[model samples]
Target chain A: MKEKEINFEEAMKQLENIANELEKGDLSLDESVNKFEEGMKLSKKCNDFLEKAEKKITMLINSDGEIKEEEFKIEEN
Target chain B: MEYNPITVTDLNKYIKEKFDGDEMLANVLVKGEISNFKRHYTGHLYFTLKDENSLIKCVMFKSYTTYLNFIPKDGMKVIILGSVNVFERDGVYQIYAKAMKQDGLGSLYEAYEKLKSKLSQEGLFDVSHKKKIPFMPKTIGVLTSNTGAVIRDIINVSTRRNPNVHIRLYPVPVQGSGAAEKIAKGIEFMNENKFADVLIIGRGGGSLEDLWPFNEEIVARAIYNSEIPIISAVGHETDFTIADFVADLRAPTPSAAAELAVANIDDVKETLRLYNNRYKIALKKRLELMRLSYEKQIARPAFKNPTQKINEQYMLIDMKVKAIQSSIQSKISEEKAKFIKQIARLDTLSPLKTLTRGYSIVTNESGKTIRKVSEIKTGENINLRLVDGEKKAKVL
Candidate 1:
């Protein structure tokens, strides 16, 4: 499968499906390696997403009848 | 009226039947403070509901306890909906409570109850209408007061699970007259702009009046119509607002809503690692199997040297050719021996050999051999031939 326009949830689901196919174990050697490469790329993509993720907290503020987003900071207790 | 007097148990049974037949007594709704509240170990609640002027004993069985979100305590004002029934053994009448709710909000409790049943009957709380909450929402829109623990707890819980999750706060009044409209408008805004992947709309625990905004019809309808899934977390665990019933999912508190919104990064990372490892192991196994088949091919003798088999065929052909050549030679020699033996026999039968053996052959001059003397009698002379010399003799 091509990696175009894929999200983390989709990638994760595809990886799991590949894992199940490999476990069933009727595929040829060539097919197995191809699937392995595809699954590996998806796994790597998911890992990169997790590692580079940043939390961006924002709030919706209405000023002069237009709604806009502003950065939100937590009030420390 | 005829009096059929008997035992006290009989009188109690008769009076119990009379109370059971009365429609007013069958469905009684009373508002009073709870006193002598006793929770039996068997899960029945024995209590006395008393106003300043009157009092009534109420017994709520274990089956009815499930509907009571809050535990009844002494002096807590509540409305009990039950029927007047008699305990025959005690010869006294008490109320069997079917449902109860915290009162003192006056008709606000009535409004809350009325809206709950109305929305429920409209199928707004149907499971089919519930939207699926995204497992990994990029942003979580929170609708609550900005000054309290509601927003704080949501932020902390969501970030703790996955630091990548964004919390977008759309602060609105949680109570008072117009709070419900603001809350409903916030839900609409989030859906219209596709603001957040999932919305968390809730506030800290409060009384029925304080949590009244969540129970409003407009807010419940907004939640029901949202394209984006919502997680309603109002008040405490026992609090059940109309929003909770209408939402796609309901969390008991704000922190729980946050937890439901985001997937843990560590766990997801672990899943990725597991897939990577499985890929390596499976690919290695496939490669190893291919290599073993290759090695098996190389180990085959015919595969090692294609000419070896041809060379073996050549050797077999040479052996067959040699056998054919030797068989022909032996046949020729056997024929040659038979020819030689026949030649020797011919030589032994030759007249020269007879002559050498001192045997004489007599014949007329015509070269014909005579076996008897009479055959040559007509001849005037008989020739006698010797091995070394010849002589002529006349016969008398």
Candidate 2:
């Protein structure tokens, strides 16, 4: 069975490696086909991971263990 | 000693006239080492011009001070252009300086320019030689005083931006004797040991004398030669130094340098999210293209009725088989008709047919239907065999 999931970093690294190998043009037809298939899977996985990510906000406190949770606003340029 | 009631301005004017008329006091060019210099907030410079034996106070307004390219420091020899004057209120004689120039190229500026030009010639300030600061540095090496607001500011800004960045402080004096050497050594050590991805060398804002170590040739050379990219953040924004020129990057303040070194974790996460979104969008587009192509292929006649293709080949074979069968049948029939004709032609010449037409097939009792007379003897019994029946007899 093909792997249905991969993290963003792993997928990106794999994609980069595949791209490099393809650029080198050393792979046989069968190997190239296999790599292309794997790259497609990884690309899909990365896209899926990115689509699901949401921005999370948290507050910072001093070493005294004080709780300070405030609404963090994203600054706009 | 006339007891005349006069205003302060009158007394000041009377004393100014007396000093202005004196030939020796007017337009005196004084040569002395400067001391206790203060640039007034109103843009006037006040300092004491002192010789080994005597000292006099002098003032140069903003109009004159702006013309000076180099900052005049304490103990620097300068030729002052001013006239002698006495204030009646304090009875103090002073040289109100109009202009001043350096007595000589002092030890500090000379060393500064010498090292700057040398390193610049060696391509230290070249853009190609400067290493780019990593977008997200994992660790930052700080070379500064152990206890100072500089470290605090750096920590505050960095942690605020990215909480996870590791900071290692290589404590060294930021000024005074041996300070430049220590700072240089710290930079070298951080680079040699690969302690951090980037280094922040800085101190808080201070007077030029306080920030002298950063201007030292040693510190500048160290920054120029550093393998790890260095961000020089010594003093305020207006302050420029040799270290600033040699460093891979220059930041106005320590906090700014820290900000440059690390990426905000939140911002990076957001960026990553955006990238992921873009990847997803691109993937979706590609898949749509693939799907469209697939649909087009499926809509093709070959895909719609695969059996039509098979039937076309099947019909070709069927036609060929029918052609072969028909040809074989016709060939067999034609040959059969030829054979029958041949048989009919043979029957006409056959002796059996002649026998039926009243010609006798002579034979002996031996039942040998003889083609020659030698096959039968005088008393031998023979039987004649025709195409319809056969009669047999024993040979005598």
Candidate that scores best on lDDT:
1
The residue pairs that clash in candidate 2, if any, are B364-B382, B365-B381, B365-B382, B366-B381, B366-B382, B367-B381, B367-B382, B367-B383
Give the runs in model 1 whose Cα sits over 4 Å from its true position.
A1-5, A22-33, B1-101, B104-122, B304-307, B347-396
Q: Estimate, for each residue in B124-191, the C-alpha lDDT of model 2 and write its tens digit.
A: 77888788887655568888876768877887788788765567776788988899888888788777
What C-alpha lDDT do the candidate models reach, one value each?
A: 0.87, 0.75
Candidate 1's error at B394, in angstroms? 16
Candidate 1 residues B1-396, lDDT tens each? 999779998999999999989999999998999999999999999999999999989999999999887768898899989999999999889999999988876687789888888999999999989999987776788999888899988888888888887788998999999999999998998899998889999999876778999999999999998999999999999889999999999999988988888888888888888988887777777778779989999989988898999999999999999999999999999999999999999998887778778977776666577688678765356666666766676556
Standalone chain B TM-score for every prediction: 0.67, 0.64
Interface RMSD after interface superposition, each candidate: 1.5, 9.5
Candidate 1, lDDT over the whole model: 0.87
lDDT of 2 by residue, A1-66 (tens): 333334344555666677666545556555655666666666665544444433332222223434
* Lowest lDDT block of 10, candidate 1 chain B: B377-386
